[model samples]
Target: MRGLKDKVAIITGGIGDLGYATAKRLFEEGCKVALFDLKQSDAGLAKAIDALYIQVDISNEEAVKLACERVENELGPAQVLVNTAATFIFKGVDATEEDWQKINSVNIVGTSFVTRYTVPQMIKKGGGSIINFSSVSGFVGQRNFATYNATKFAIRGLTKCWAYDLAEHGIRVNTLCPGYIYTSAFVNSCKVLNLDIEEENKRASEMHLLNRQGQPEEVAAAAAFLASDDSSFITGSDLLVDGGYLAK
Candidate 1:
């Protein structure tokens, strides 16, 4: 919680449930927040928190570069960067090259690009925190989830390497690995799959030791800790906000 006030923070995929929740928490903590996403958000959502919202495809390197620059110009050089932008594509060995390309472009490459540009600003500020979102999927196998799982695993790997690379400049890089969280995306996916919502919810809840899916705010709290000086001693580590799912 310390070292957050008036700090510039960027949350990629900011319009989404998790990202938006994190942004709101950071804003409440007195940080200047910026939301970057491919989709346009309700103006009121950003206005409600007095945060900047930019619609940009993180997968596009040039676009990401410009967007980071805009954040610097508008919100000041970001002292915190949360790479929450991701694309989900579930498939096993049957996954095609196109599926790999689509998911990898956004999940792996886009996350790297955003961090690439943001690191300089952080270095300029003499230090920063970078929270890369991984998942329980990153640490274990899942049925027909090779495409998505692979990228999640890669995020953990990247965070460790970046932690080492950035340490000299006082930057900390760590992975936030959360279990299934009850989000709008979960609801939408259930609708698309034509699954019974309550049944699916029950199924997901059973997967966690806590007997329920995690909430966006819960994950946001973990992220806030990582973004704040409270986690100053942690870096190159995977903080499991997984509701003991991995333990079970």
Candidate 2:
């Protein structure tokens, strides 16, 4: 919790469950918050938290650059950056080149573009924290998940490299890998695939030792720790908030 007060923080995909939770936590910890997404956030939510919302397509370098600049101008140089914007595409070896491109552009390249622009601001403020979201998929393969898993794995890889590259500048980079979190996205995906929500939920819940899926706020707590000085000694590591899912 230390080192979080008065810091400027940015959360990409801020309208999403996990991202929104993280933003709320950071804001509560006295950090000025900014949310970035491809679409505008609900006015009530943004106003409730007294945070700024910026519509941005992270895959577009120009859009990312402008958004970062705008944040700096409005909220001050960002000292914490959480990259949560991603595209999800579940496919196997049969995945088309287009599938790969669509997922990679957002999950990988988009993450990089946001980080690329935010680093300078962090450097200006004498260092910062960067939390990149990965998933249990990053550590293990799943059936029909080649497309999505690849990007998650790459996120961890990028986090490690960025940790080393930015350490001298006082920036710490780490990956937040969560297990199956009960989110709107999860239920919606089940609907899209014509799977029973209850059945799918049971399947996912059983995958973790806790016998339940995680909540967005639970994951948000981990992100807050990483964002604060409490995790100053940790970097280039994979922090699993997976409900002991990996223990098995």
Candidate 3:
């Protein structure tokens, strides 16, 4: 994990559950994290790490470009890029077009923007790693999550194609697909579905082969590997850190 030492990383959505955990892990590995999140995200993770953080929504292209410029000016070219910022939707076809556009913009389009801005820097720096945050829903399917599933699935497609495109530039592109994990989002989802929080937690645990819901740190560990030399030979692979959910 410490192989990430001396590297600079630009981690999107770097203040929330998964993002915060990843940032902590990267910091522990001796990497400097330039976090791009919303206005609130800066506050959420400020006390946790001493790093450069910018407030910008993922769906805004100009905002992201500005954020990248600032990141490059403030912290050197990013040697590692982790596109973890995403908006989750749990609605089915009944989901409104506006909502669909919003989620798709952030989860898919915004991911592209971050990649667009960061890749050149990686190339100039002699290549690097790009790890995307996809989900199990992309591999299989999930109910009442059509909008979300679309974006996650699109992320995998992006990963696959980018792996080949960036390979010549010496950049590795891979996707990290996680199953259901315990987070504020999950807790809110349980409430929205009218299920008892504790009950749903137990249910999620049983759904996984490990009989437990994964923590953010679990996925963060995988990100560390993909970002470091440990996974130098890994590209275009969907690494499932889902506690065996897909195995079942």
C-alpha lDDT score of every prediction, in listed order: 0.96, 0.95, 0.88
The deviation in Å at residue 115 for candidate 1 is 0.3
lDDT by residue for model 1 (111-134), tens: 999999999999999999999999
TM-score, one value per model: 0.99, 0.98, 0.95
> How many residue pairs clash in each candidate at the backbone level?
0, 0, 0
Predict model 1's lDDT versus the native: 0.96
Comparison by TM-score, 2 against 3, better one: 2
Can you give the lDDT of residue 167 in candidate 1?
98
Error of 3 at 24 (Å): 0.6
Candidate 1 off by > 4 Å: none
Evaluate residue 169 in candidate 1 and report its C-alpha lDDT on the 0 to 100 scale. 98
| Residue-level lDDT for 62 in candidate 1 | 95
Candidate 3 per-residue lDDT, tens place, 55-105, comes to 899788898888888888887888899999988767997999899889988
lDDT of candidate model 3 versus the reference: 0.88
